[model samples]
Target: MNAVLRTLVVLVSLVVAAPVLAAPAADVDLVKQRVAKVGVLRGEFSQEKQVAGFKNPLRSQGRFVLAQDHGVVWTTLKPFPSEVVVTRDRILSRQRDGSSRVELDGRQQPAMRSVNAIMFALMSGDAQALAAQFTVKVEAKANNGWSMQLSPRSAMLGKVFTGLKLQGDRYVREVEITEANQDVTRIHFSGMSETPAALSAEEGGKFE
Candidate 1:
């Protein structure tokens, strides 16, 4: 079978299996509550991107900081150095020299605004927000861990991303994004630290 056809089969199988998917909703609620109490989070991440026809998956490593009140700072340290800051109002990409390479105001771009909301929901573990945009299924695993599958509800988004799978104990540790045409992006997060204190000036400045 061709790659596109194979991907369609995989997606169809996932949808057909959805009826049997079941887990404790209360457990997910408790996990969301625990995540809500965390105001600041810092972690390191490694990401792998696979595209159809590519001989090898592209790999990148990075660190990130998420402040509920401020925004998110994502620094890519591998392959090349780059940074992206996403806030409620705008998204900015900064070069290694601390100059802005690109900036998109959410007020002007509806698509970008939606992207910002989804990123924040993913980073914050906002179950309510996530549920509003995707159909979710949760399953508990051994060792106090859990997994969730989220399928996009919007037709437009469905064309871009068919589904996402997230796994974690208390905080999100891994995310797998399955897109149309059989491409996939997987991110693994580790060394997470959650704090109640505010972000430092430098971290906060990224959003500005």
Candidate 2:
């Protein structure tokens, strides 16, 4: 994938932990109560992107780590080995040979700073933060399962993302992102865990 597409994938992967809720205040509280709060969450993910005019969707599978205090580590192991790490200050990507590149520097790009804040809020299940950006519609299901649809509220965000749909019970299981150009990306998360409650030494090194 090109750098811009790769960056979009990284952003989608980081928000997999977001809580799905309705626009109503009570529903927001209800959804928050249902989602599991943890300092660290790790999982495996499979993503498929359906680009306009492409007959087949592009697919990739990988693993991800979300640390509330640190940031996210997304490792793409198929098709090619690569990794993307997002922290408060910047977004970094690594090649299989250990070469690292700064994808975005929040200090220099004010827009990236906002993106970083949104990412952190999503992963941390900050419903209020989400509500400020997207108009959310939620459906409650049996067994505490629920689903939500989100549309960007700002003109800037709307220029890129058309909408998003997310679903889960205790954790977000699926996410579908629709772009303005009609390209759609679907992501499924599995093997999620909160155990270990901390990053491994090697994983921690990626942030530095």
Candidate 3:
């Protein structure tokens, strides 16, 4: 994966790890109830990556669409234009003019299955699926807000990420990822909406 694609994957992976709140089943249920159940969600994001030795964090802004049972379309609009579409079958990166930059087939890359499973679970708020892979701790915040801390359960995942933190009210508002090398990435989501309730024709076509 290229730098942009790798960053996107890390973002998605951190999201997938968010639901593993280690609180009681009732607490988890409360979080589930608080999250909006929508077929389609659209939002804007600002991301910052702080490398171990860098004095300044790399920043980028973007928009994203998450379609239930379909996939995610992430379009980075600043620091250069690019798009990454991730579906169950493949991960495709496209250039500014819409030419394919790279593609990874799920059949050829077994890891794609895991990535897809996590991505879908994150989009759907599937706590059980996420809890299976991470050690989670959840805390209920005021005004219907909640926060979670996650640590990888297996050594393999641990090699990639040391820990993750997520906070949100009705939807995920922020995610922080700490990689094994001590680099950190923080993502904030804004302008979230469930309006339209379904993907538009253009958005739907990206999944294909």
Candidate number with greatest lDDT:
3
- Write candidate 1's Cα lDDT for 69-129 as tens digits: 8778888888778887777777777666765476666667544555565688776666566
Residue ranges of candidate 1 with Cα displaced over 4 Å:
1-30, 34-36
> Total backbone clashes of model 1?
0
Query: How accurate locally, in lDDT, is each candidate?
Result: 0.70, 0.73, 0.76
Clashing residue pairs, backbone N/CA/C < 3 A, model 2: none
C-alpha RMSD of each candidate structure in angstroms: 7.7, 4.9, 4.1
Candidate 2, which segments miss by more than 4 Å at Cα? 1-26, 121-125
Candidate 3 lDDT, 1-208, residue by residue in tens: 4455785466445544443334234346666777787889999999899999999998989999988778888888888788888888788898768655888787776557667766565544555556766766778889998887777876667778899887888898888889999999898989999998888999999888
The TM-score between candidate 1 and the true structure equals 0.81
- Candidate topping TM-score: 3
Error of 3 at 96 (Å): 2.3
TM-score of each: 0.81, 0.85, 0.87
Rank order (by lDDT, best first): 3, 2, 1
As a whole number from 0 to 100, the lDDT of residue 136 in candidate 3 is 68
TM-score of candidate 3 versus the correct structure, residues matched by position: 0.87
